[model samples]
Target: MDAFYASVEQLDHPEWRGKPLVVGGNEARGVVAAASYEARKFGIHSAMSSALAAKKCPHLIFARPRFERYKEISLQIRDIFYEYTDLVEPLSLDEAFLDVTENKVGLKSAILIARQIRAKIKEKTGLNASAGVSYNKFLAKTASDLNKPNGQAVILPEEAEAFLEKLPIGKFFGIGKVTAEKMQKLGIHNGKDLKEYSLQFLTKKFGKSGLHYYNIVRGIHLSEVQPHRVRKSLSAENTFEKDLISLQEMEAHFYPIFEEVVRRIEKSGIKGRTVTVKIKFSDFSQQTRSKTLEQYPNADQLWEVGLELLRQEEIPKPVRLLGLGISNLNLTEEQVYFGEQLKIPFHISNGKG
Candidate 1:
């Protein structure tokens, strides 16, 4: 999917096509959920403040998100994926990992399957999708973004090493801003530099994650494409237009967020034993306080824990954002059964895992 939410909006409303569009709340505190390529040319992107987005592109069109419609389209796309392979790992509403190694169509070429999948999606939904075909999930996901709307890229086993060597460390999947900066300080600007570090040295510097970096740079990732990945946590956060200077203001914002998280928990039919309160200061520093109960907490119980965590903050600062989350999740019996049924043996990788 390309610019999923904004693209969907453009598809349904023909007049908005080729114009800079943003899909999200048009409020003072609103954030950009999605932006069209036209909007991107103005330096607008998802997670940016809607106010700032408008400042960047004065004519940026704003539309409220239609998640229900997006979910409907997502299901349609997933159905298309199932026509080829049962091993589909959905990362979000618009992206997924499909292991088509032993597809129902008996396709020997993953690249062909990717092309056909994109073609079918466009045929069914009147939308464009980009795809990447590779031997492992990391390369596949990385390559998927190499091209823009309605394009496809394939990274063969023979080309993997050279392809990775020159790639920027920041562009690698799972590497964040903080981690990339740390790597740069250590003279690791690209895959070639990252590969120079020994596994033991990397582990010593970055803990367990160092091993992942070491192997990934060398084009080795053993993690299987898990289709039935479970949700480990659920959360909801809000960034305020103005920093909250008083405890009263923080409490007022916290309750609505708490309710929203509870609503999602109930809707998902999952509960967690741990409750956490996340606070971000005006300076962008963050802190989280968590407490784990003996059993999964109900909404009321979770709220009590959340309030306690907020009150326990030793040194309060003007807060820019506040969030409530629950973890240590337990799935329902139905979910457990579904997971069991979805579990499958890993497809043998053509490249080093």
Candidate 2:
């Protein structure tokens, strides 16, 4: 699923193929959900501000995401995957980790299974799919992207070390812009360079992720293809268009996100004990203010506690990003009483000076 949302749009609308298409809101505050390869040529990317994307590519054709259609297609793909193995762990609508160790089809080769699955996906959905076959999840995930838009790539266990040795560090999972910069600073420009450092050294520098880097360098990643991992939390955070110095401004901005989170909580039927407010300064320093309530909460009460936390924070600098998260979920009978209290109209504690 290369450029998944944009690719879906292109598949459904043939005329948009080979052209710059952006799937997201085309308004002032909207962000790019996906960008077609053509759009990527112009430096447009997903999660970028749609307004900024348009500025980058004046001819960008923007379309709002059709999540229902994507979901339907995803289900169809999952069904196809079940023909091979039940050990399918979906990473997203377009990508998954499949454990073909003991496949139902008794296919001697995972590469052949990958190819057959890709073909079936194209035939059933009238769209292209890329497949990757390897000895493990890390290599398989990397192999999948080697070829895109109806492509397949394979990595044998014997070739794993060589494959990683030549690979760039940036291509590794969990090595984003920040980590890449730090790696480069440490003379770790690629897999070969990364392998030079001892595991202890990496772990000391990067904590838990350093161990992952060490294993990946040796082509020894042991992470399993877990099926349908239960979601522990659902939250959204946003960086403001402009920085805020005052609590009043923060409160006004938090209002909508708070309401939206509550709506989401109700819809998902998730009860959380802890509500956290994340704040980032213009200098990029970050801090969190949180509260653990006596009972589980719905949207209204969640926001009330969230605002309370925001009021207690000292504004040492202009705030750049504001985020809200609910965790330590209460998925039991106690949740019902908490919901009732939240729904009951009452005065909210502003927690502001």
Candidate 3:
């Protein structure tokens, strides 16, 4: 899918097509959940403050996010994936990795499979889709973004090494801005530079993740497309329009987030022992505190642990955002106990794991 949320908005509302439209946010508050290509041209993007987005493009149109609609379309797309391969691993509503090594259609060429998939998507959903055909997940995920807005790219095994050698380290999949900056300080600006470091040196510098970086640069990724990937955590967060000055005010806002996390955990029929509180200050710096129980907690226990974590925070500055999360999940098929139904608003639901 290309510019998924914004694209869906355009698909349903033809008048907005080809215009500079954003899916989530307002000029005064909130953040951009998705941006159209027209909006992107003006430097607007997902996670950008709506205020800044409006300043960049004064005429930009904003639409409230429609998550339920997006999920409906996502299911439709997943059904399409099932037509070709059962080994489809969805990374998000907009993206997935498919192992067509043994597909239902008996298609042998991955490139053709990609093209066919994109065509089918356009035909069924009236949306353009981009794809990347490669020998492994890392390369496929990386290549998927090379061409944008309804395009496809392929990296054959023969071309993988040389192509990666010329690729910038920052462009590598899973490498964040901070890590890229650290790599640059160590004179590793490209794949070729990264390949020169010893596995021992990388492990010392990066811990367990060093092996991943080392293998990926050499085009040696071996991970498979896992269709039933288990979620490790459930969380909900809110960014305030204005900074909160008191702990009382912060707690007032955090209650819903705390409840939302518990609601999701129970809804999934899964239990987790650890509850974490995440706090972001006015300066954009952040901190997290967590508590773990020997046994799965009920609603009251979860709330108490979360509240304790938040109350323990030494107020260093005005708070900009607060979040609550649960992790250390137990994946067994057991009924999780969450005392009773919450009193949250019927329309106010947002939790992601």
lDDT per residue (tens digit) for residues 1-353 in model 2: 77887888889888788989888656444567788989999999887876788788877787756767887888898999999998988877888899998999998888889889988988998778888888888888889889986798998889988888888889986689999999999998888999989989999999999889999878888889887565656566666666788889989987866776777777777878889988888766889888888888866688788888998847789986787888888554322111111111112122100
Alpha carbon lDDT at 86, candidate 3:
89
TM-score ranking, best first: 3, 1, 2
lDDT of 1 by residue, 83-197 (tens): 9988888888899999988999998999999999999999999999999889999999999999978899988889998999999999999999899999999999999999999
Give per-residue CA lDDT, model 3, range 31-145, as digits (tens): 6889999999999999888789989998888876777788788888989999999898887888889999999999799999899989988999999999988999999988898
Q: In terms of TM-score, how similar is model 3 to the real structure?
A: 0.90
Whichever of 1 and 3 has more TM-score, that candidate is 3
Global Cα lDDT for candidate 2: 0.79
The candidate that achieves the highest TM-score relative to the unseen native structure: 3
Per-model clash counts, in order, read 1, 1, 0
Q: How many backbone clashes does candidate 2 have?
A: 1
**What are the candidates' C-alpha RMSDs?**
9.0, 7.8, 4.8
lDDT of 2 at 75: 86
Which residue pairs clash within candidate 2? 262-299
Q: Which pairs in model 3 have colliding backbones? A: none
